[model samples]
Target: MPKALKIAPPDDVLTMLEAGVAGDRVAFDGGSVQLIDAVERGHKVALHAIERNAPVRKFGFPIGRATRSIAAGEHVHVHNLQTALAGQHSYAFDTGANVVTPLPSTATFMGYRRADGRVGTRNEIWVLPTVGCVARTAERIARQAEARVAHLVDGVHAFAHPHGCSQLGHDLDGTRAILASLACHPNAAGAVIVGLGCEENQVAALLERIPQARRGSIRFLVAQASADEMAEGVALVEELARAAMAVRSPAGLDALVLGVKCGGSDGLSGLTANPLVGRMADHVTGAGGSAILTEIPEIFGAEHLLMARAASRATFDAIVTLVNGFKQHFIDHGEPVSENPSPGNIAGGITTLEEKSLGAVQKGGTSAVVDVIDYGVQVRARGLTVLEAPGNDAVSSTALAAAGATVILFTTGRGTPLGFPVPTVKIASNHDLAVRKPGWIDFDAGMVLDAGMDAADAALLQRIIAIASGEETAAERNGEREIAIWKRGVTL
Candidate 1:
């Protein structure tokens, strides 16, 4: 039988588990409703008649207002509904209804310990270009050094980006901060600072921020100064490889910094993958580990849920600003605050930005907001830290990596082929996506719908620990590692 799921008590629509045509019956908790219009799997169906311009409720919140009158059992989607959000609104800090608790510890993983006492899941040498001009040189250096260090390190790679030059103010400063933070990442035991001879992002300025203890392992090269850039680059890379070459030792899981993100989401995302990832967040935080959650825009509608779990009133205030400030970012551009949940998301049963946000925030897993940090800054909090960043996958992933995420858990329903510099484990929301994109998906949470969250949670934990202990994700195996900086300011 094709059944329907009502996520929350106040939900006015049901998400169909399987596709059904007109006259088809969808059974729920008590009675069954015959379909008045066809609905595809992972799409919505109205539970009752909704008048034109009335709020269309899903997940216990109004996703949007009906464009036209909607009959009971009719398919609810983009054609009949539209985003209700217009602009940003003032938010009040409210954290009264919450229980105070402490993060418990119980697990460990094998990792490399840096001189400054930070732990890393991978012991690889990284190459960073001050500008895009030296990107190829950096990659060439990494490719050559990768072969030499194959028997010693996890992997060697160069991060390439388009910016670092032809910018001013915060834009240029952002590039500098992100690159510097990546240079300081615990995962990279050593790094080569590649300069394009005259780029605004100078190696001297970059090197000034790197910890003095790790300076001996870092190398700086100016393309114009060297007679043979390739030779010079490779020589520097070789030095980095030699310094970074080390074996993984048993480290407490508390030392791990995990990044949580979701993209290409569907209705099942909240029902399965995101919640399971949240459970993983609780587990990690409970174990004294850190988990960073970004994509500020996606968490807009559900901002209150996290605010309620904030560790302090100051944290709640910061979160309110984080939410409102992002909303204003859209209004400043003359766009609607809830103008999101891409076409793929709409096809996957998301009607409005709020609907998408409600599902997207499930990845944070009911953890308290310990701190809030801006983009390009290394995270200092140990629990669930909210980062200020756009919802773009590459940009957000790179930001998380810069914030010192050793491993990133990326949940997707429509699926993504991209990966960040760090090991990215893609968790599929549906079993079909997992089956179709085996090379892209590392874990499938669809089984939760059939098996249960606890069982899926255990399986996911096992896979995460395995990856932390030196296992390669699908992204790493396919060599899809990349970086993207959020370019907010003008190019000039």
Candidate 2:
């Protein structure tokens, strides 16, 4: 028999757990409903009669309003629902006590201790191009140098991007900031910054942004200045590799920094994968670690939930500015703030931006909002930080890595094979996706539906520790490593 779930007590809709044909009886908590129309799995069915313009509640909040009077057991979707979001609104900081008991720092992982006192999950050599003109050159240097230093470091890779030139003001500054951050990333014990000297982003200017302490292991090369740039790059990497060798030591759980993200989310994402990740976030933060939550536009209708949990009045005010600023960006572009729930999201049974945002924010669990930082800035706070970034998968994931995330917990219901600068643990929201794409999913959060959260949480936490201790994720095995910078300004 098909089954359905009513997520919260105030919810007026039931989400179908399995596909049901017309006239099929589906059971829920209170009563059974005979389907009036054929409904697909993950789709919502009205639990009771709803009048036109009435709020449809899910997750104990209004997802949208009924476009027309909806009969009991009828399908509740885009046809009958409409978003209630409009322009930005004012908000007041709630003075409730938001406290999280810090867990005893018992958990530990084997990691490399950097000279600057930060722990690194990997000790690889990275080649970064300062401009698009030298991207291929950087790649060639990495490929050639990896063979020579394969036994010394974990691996050698290059992150190539195209926005180092023809950008002005903040656009140019953002590009430089991100590059400088990547060069100083703990994962890369040593980095070779390759530059075309004539570009807008000069190697010297970019180097100025990097702290003097981190510059010891970083090498800079100008292709225009050297006759044999590739050979010189390889030699520099070889020297750094020899000097970058460090023994793995036991590091406390407090040393871990996580970037939580979601992509290709389905209806069950909130109930399973996202909430599972939220558990992990709470566990990490409670142990004095840090977790970052980005994708600003996706939080449009659900910002109030986070605002109420702000750690301080200043933190609450920063969140308001972060959210409203993103909304204004949308307005300036002549786009609607509620223009979300991509085609895949609709196919996966998500209805509006509110519904998606509600599910998306679950990755942060119930942690208080500790801080809010701009794009390309590294995380400074030790708890939950809300970052300023858009909702694109690559852009947000890359921003997460640059913000000092040693590992990223990425949840997906529709699956992807993309990885960023760090180890990306892809979690599936349903069992079917995990079984169908084993090569793409590292953990099956769908098991929460059957085995329950306690069993699943322990298993997932074990996997995170193992991955942090040098285990390769599915994305690593497939060689899906890549990075993308947010390009918000004009090309010229």
Best by TM-score: 2
lDDT of each: 0.85, 0.90
Residues forming the 10-long window of minimal summed lDDT in candidate 2: 96-105
lDDT per residue for candidate 2 within 1-492, as digits (tens), equals 346764546888888877888898877776778889888887889888999999999888999999999998899999999899887889998873654554544678888888777888888999999999999999999999999999999989999898799988899999998889989899999999999889999999999989999999899999999999999999999999998877788987788889999999988898889989988888888888899999999998999988988999999999999999999999999999999999998888899999999999989978788999999999999889999889999999999989999999999989999999899999999888999999999999978878889899889988998999899999999988898988988888
Report clash pairs, candidate 1: 104-286, 278-365
Alpha-carbon TM-score of each model against the true structure: 0.96, 0.98
Model 1 residue 99 CA deviation in Å: 5.4
Each candidate's clash count:
2, 0
RMSD of 1: 1.7
Off by over 4 Å in 2: 98-105
- After superposition on all CA atoms, what RMSD does each candidate show versus the true structure? 1.7, 1.3
